[model samples]
Target chain A: MRVLGIDPGLTRCGVGVVDVEPNRTAKLVDVVVLRSPADLDTPNRLVRIADGLEAIIDEHRPQAVALERVFARSDVSTIMGTAQISGVAMLLAARRRLPVALHTPSEVKAAITGYGRADKAQVGAMVARILGLEAVPKPADAADALALAICHAWRTGGVAGAAVTDASAPAPLARTTTPAQQAWLAAERSAAVSGAARRLKK
Target chain B: MRVLGIDPGLTRCGVGVVDVEPNRTAKLVDVVVLRSPADLDTPNRLVRIADGLEAIIDEHRPQAVALERVFARSDVSTIMGTAQISGVAMLLAARRRLPVALHTPSEVKAAITGYGRADKAQVGAMVARILGLEAVPKPADAADALALAICHAWRTGGVAGAAVTDASAPAPLARTTTPAQQAWLAAERSAAVSGAARRLKK
Candidate 1:
């Protein structure tokens, strides 16, 4: 399954695309930060951002979009910009008949780092490890976008029975898990056990 | 000059179009409230609002757009929705090459009612009177949208040198006031004097 993740902002919007396999591995397709100058009027700035987003969508053609859910913050102006760009992203997705899924910051962090309160560096490290990247994507927004994409893919059980797959593909197993799924579950369990051991040692 | 005013909201967006003359008189062209169901997802609801706005613009062919500026308030969610829709409005206007002017709530009130703190009823009454309508536009949003359009027209000195007018039209005078401009200024001064007199009496 191909997922496009967006961390929306007026001045800097982060976009990342990833292809995920049913085996819970992800491959980086593209990642970039879209920026608009501050001196420009709000309307024109939005047009710039919208154009960048449209270009990315047209080039990548992802099956789904994962957007960061905006929340009220201390900086009112910043939050307003975030919300505005997020709305634009969702509108673009809807126009293309693509499904949009909103994920909270903490949800992405937890999905990537196995801890809801994980710091940015931790999430970035996990994302690099998951995608087999040489370095964490530059700029926090880029890494965050990648994390969102990985989170969505993992949460949706990767590409099993996804639309992009063959129509004759069997439905996702209910009681029985595929070998890859079992391995993934076992890896998670091992990680949890090691985390508990570290806490005990502390 | 034809102006399209938008009082943007996610659930019910108010839109009004008016034709304004250099004499400070305005005739209502169209006014309607575009609604999207709350039950619908945000993306779909936004798409619906965008479609409605596009249809109105196509039909009216307004020369400019006047949108209410969003501000932070106690209701964070409401403010977010307002900002989002406002962004959409601006983007639409930009795409059509129509200049967008944003007016704060107090500015709209002051322009329409000669008082910055006028209540909704007072503003609505002024809008209806200015448009020569028998009744105030239904729903506060509709009235507010018209007020925005009228305010923009009045602030920009109406249609004297507007693009919709003939290119050979004379430029707006600086020192020498036109008869209509003088009358409009006199009316504003009279309103100010009366307001002060009333305050003194109180």
Candidate 2:
């Protein structure tokens, strides 16, 4: 399947398209950086971001959207900018009803750099080397975005091809509760812990 | 080819292995969560994380490791924790001499959700549904990890299968660049702009 990976930002959004096959070899289709000035007002910037996202999607028409999962509390400005950028992407994906998946930054870095904490440069270099390229990708943001795409392609291809061994373990989903339910349970657990601590102290 | 996606954290690391085929379908071979409690010292945690990673790799034997890219502020404490977790992942992959790729969170979310701003629950729900599961996956982290694998599978499959349309486009290697180069360019640009501004004022 063709996976379209995007690194969302209000000012410098990056998009990458990658193709994967059964043998685990991956090819880079298209990778580009789309940027806007940070000075632009929120609404206009968002619109521009949306337009940029739509253009990439229209051009690529990928079967699925492989996006990076957001981390909260990165700072208000950063978070807001990221959220705006992310919003544009989701709007387009939902418009097309395309399935979407989100991955964390560490996950993407670990997949590409062999080090979860590898900086952008390491990731860029590793992405180039992994694909058997001679030079590291340019514009760190774009390279990072491409790395995201490559990671998705590799992991998804492995899963889809059934190459991973099951190890005869039961599925985790079998006994797990949904997020909403888990939240409720978590509250109860905390309350109980507090109660026990109070009783002991008294 | 089998792709392994790892979502690294100090406490719980989520790992997923997926196999992709020529026709663009993914089959889950294995998914697991590794836990290293905060009660353990940093070194012990690192050891635990490393051991868990090695064990997973040994069982799965993925051709490539796709990790999420982490970008943290210069804050000492946060950076240290991130570094340790990332270091373990890197050590594991490097020990095996396996190729690795890193991607930012925005990129992964965009790839999967077509919107960089997708919420965790939304991402989890979509991942489950895309894999043809009955409901959303639990422990948001695990689902995100799985999604990362799925994204990699799709992108790389297209590349390896020669499905990409733009042969003229830069290959994956073209974008990777060292941070020093980027810094130098930024400085140069700033100087040039300052000179231009002076000229304009004159």
Q: For candidate 1, what is the interface RMSD?
A: 10.5
Tens digits of per-residue lDDT, candidate 1, A38-70, equal 767777788999999999999999888888878
lDDT of 1: 0.78
- For A1-202, candidate 2 gives per-residue lDDT tens digits of 6777888776688888777665656777788888766654343455566667778788988766666655556454565456445534644565575555555687677556545676786777666765667887778777877777776655454332221111111321123335554464345345533553234234
Docking outcome class, model 2: incorrect
Pairing residues by index, what is the TM-score of model 1? 0.84
TM-score of each: 0.84, 0.41
Off by over 4 Å in 2: A1-202, B73-79, B158-202
In model 1, what lDDT does residue B53 have? 97
The lDDT per prediction is 0.78, 0.59
RMSD of each: 7.7, 25.6
TM-score of chain B of each: 0.82, 0.74
The i-RMS of every model, in angstroms, reads 10.5, 19.6
Candidate 2's displacement at residue B171, Å, is: 11
